[model samples]
Target: MSGNARPSLTMKSRCLLTHRAMYGAEQLGSLPCVLHTIDMLIRDDVIWLFWFDHQGVIQSFGVKFVQHTPMFLLVLMALQRFNTANWGLPNGLPHGAPADEFVKLEELTAEHSTSDSQSSSISVNWSARTCRSLHFVGRCTQIFDALVRRRDAAVAKLSFPDVSRVSEAVIVQRAREVQTAKFDLQRHLPVLHFVADVRPQMSAIREFLNITTDACVARLTIWEKLTPIVHLRGADFRRCWFELIHAHHLLWNHGIRHLDPSAANMMVRYVGGASRCPQ
Candidate 1:
């Protein structure tokens, strides 16, 4: 919670706060140059949450926006909508709010599953309310907050029967390259990409979200050329392991404590052939 302890903001002020908070940070896109640029001017204490899209575009959302109305009013409208529809308030409405007022998106999970059938897609509830900022609370609690969204990248269920192209020498070389690349925020912890050419791709991905460090953290997920599965925890993975420990040290060095260091907060993704380090 903010220490200022001011009165509740007016509705209009809440709306501006919503936009200012939502648009505060630029989420990282897939481009390499974006990985290097960190824009701090746009970042502030108001942002509530961050979301990323399939193309690596990031969208930060405060409360939830419904046309021009602030989130609290929208909640009332949703309640009215549900009442008119004749749907009784379900069991899980927060504080027993009505269906329309607080629609039950789903039983919560690691990510929101869109439907029982869609395996590749996920969605999150986007609201523009005036409640206390969620991200701020998470930070106050010292939890390692993260915004994860799944992608349509290649997925494979079965292994290839043919062993025509297995080579230990190539894996060793790629692993070394992944372990040695120069990175800023997430150095040594595995999410490195080997982009032969990054300029054109950078421009294209910029539309999804501004590639600035202050907004979103970036990690390259590299797929094996022959197989869809990528490898992490390779022989050269010690660099990333040490990097994570060093980062933890620096955080404590600055007198900040991360109360939550669960596996979800410290994710490891594979690049080329090597594993990215844990958070």
Candidate 2:
């Protein structure tokens, strides 16, 4: 497996990942998994689990493999030993995986009496299972798309390269800034809330064409939908502006000069009465 050669997952791999997740009888949308990369290395395959009864991800998990090294194996063994020594504690193992989590390692067995090439390669085929349930998870993406479309349409009506309340030049600048925001969104994948899980049988690494064979681990997180001020209107719009100004002065009074505020990073949340602002 080469480090830099990441072609999209093969058709077989895609077929194997049938449901992004399986919750009871519900199988969700096409390939709900995303990749975690580090220094151009493929790290973990992140997955989200949902219940139709819940608004967003009810739970999520990541699966990663560690292989081809004794040091790594020793570390895993130490943790396993620690877990074994501490089984009576109310909490699970100190260095063990999350509760309600399990990993089904591919071909967990004695090492093959063959060359490293033959022994180290592990093939994980997930799409082979027949799912008993199906569900869809775009309620959040739908809202995001709708707001973005409305924002784009509004921006599209702006008169650029012409004189207006603000200079035509400033309008051009604003348009470019919006484009930068679009590109920024395209280049980033962000999420929240983290609970880690290491597979119980996750040590084996199988051979795959153009894939990573490194020591890696998987952790889970909550996905969030962000609201940019450009997508906001009415009182919502005014509130963001208030926050921007309030935040600026809050910094200024603290002996700091807050300059270069951009709409790109300003995320909005609605609150009432005494509010707490988290930055």
Candidate 3:
């Protein structure tokens, strides 16, 4: 809700207002959602939401306020096609998204099932991309691949079983690295994403309809569940510093820049009873 809104808005009013746009992202596969009050961006009043399937599992969503349409869906898949080497904490889309082999490309999952039939892959055919932005198509094949798209591919690689076959020490190190990647993916990355517009409606239009907005594009990102960073203590806290450094280099060299990182945005990821911190 905007601060200058003529009439103060209720939460339900806000939720109802945004629901159609959020639900339009049919590929996210989330169940019905309820808007929550965890304010994310003050400038756009972007907040959080909770989604629950029939079985009652919780899925979290955070809204990223932006003006232009995000091109992550294109840029990330292109990166996977261009890059040959895999980063330690794989850019999350992990093994990679092939531009041509669009079929069975695997939607992201922390479970990292080696079997292909388990998940649905995101696909875009020539005809489907007709309405997309020209810049989006150009960047998808050129430099500056969508940083957020890079996130999904990064997440796909997390939790992957390290297949390194060397000395016992090397094997042990690689396994730890895999654990760290999975922990970081859940703690720091956006696993699922979609864009929506949340602009204002004219008074007359509002009275008759619920489906109009301008170009105030916002990207809603869903992430793995996380624990508060406050849970880290003593040795756990100190160890987190090193892990954060490792995660940073992996992301920076591979092409994702985390602009605003702080304790407020960081989380404590526990894997096998150890606090795995990804800054």
Estimated TM-score for each candidate? 0.23, 0.22, 0.28
Give the poorly placed runs of model 3, Cα more than 4 Å off: 1-214
What's the CA error at residue 133 for candidate 2, in Å? 25
Overall local distance difference test of candidate 1: 0.30
Give stretches of model 1 more than 4 Å off.
1-183, 186-237, 262-265
Backbone clash pairs in model 2 (N, Cα, C under 3 Å; residues 3+ apart or in different chains), count: 9
Ranking by lDDT: 3, 1, 2
Clashing pairs in 2: 16-127, 25-133, 27-133, 27-134, 121-206, 121-207, 122-205, 122-206, 122-207
Q: Could you tally the backbone clashes for each prediction?
A: 20, 9, 11
Please give the CA lDDT of all the candidate structures.
0.30, 0.29, 0.32
Best by lDDT: 3
lDDT of 1 at 93: 16
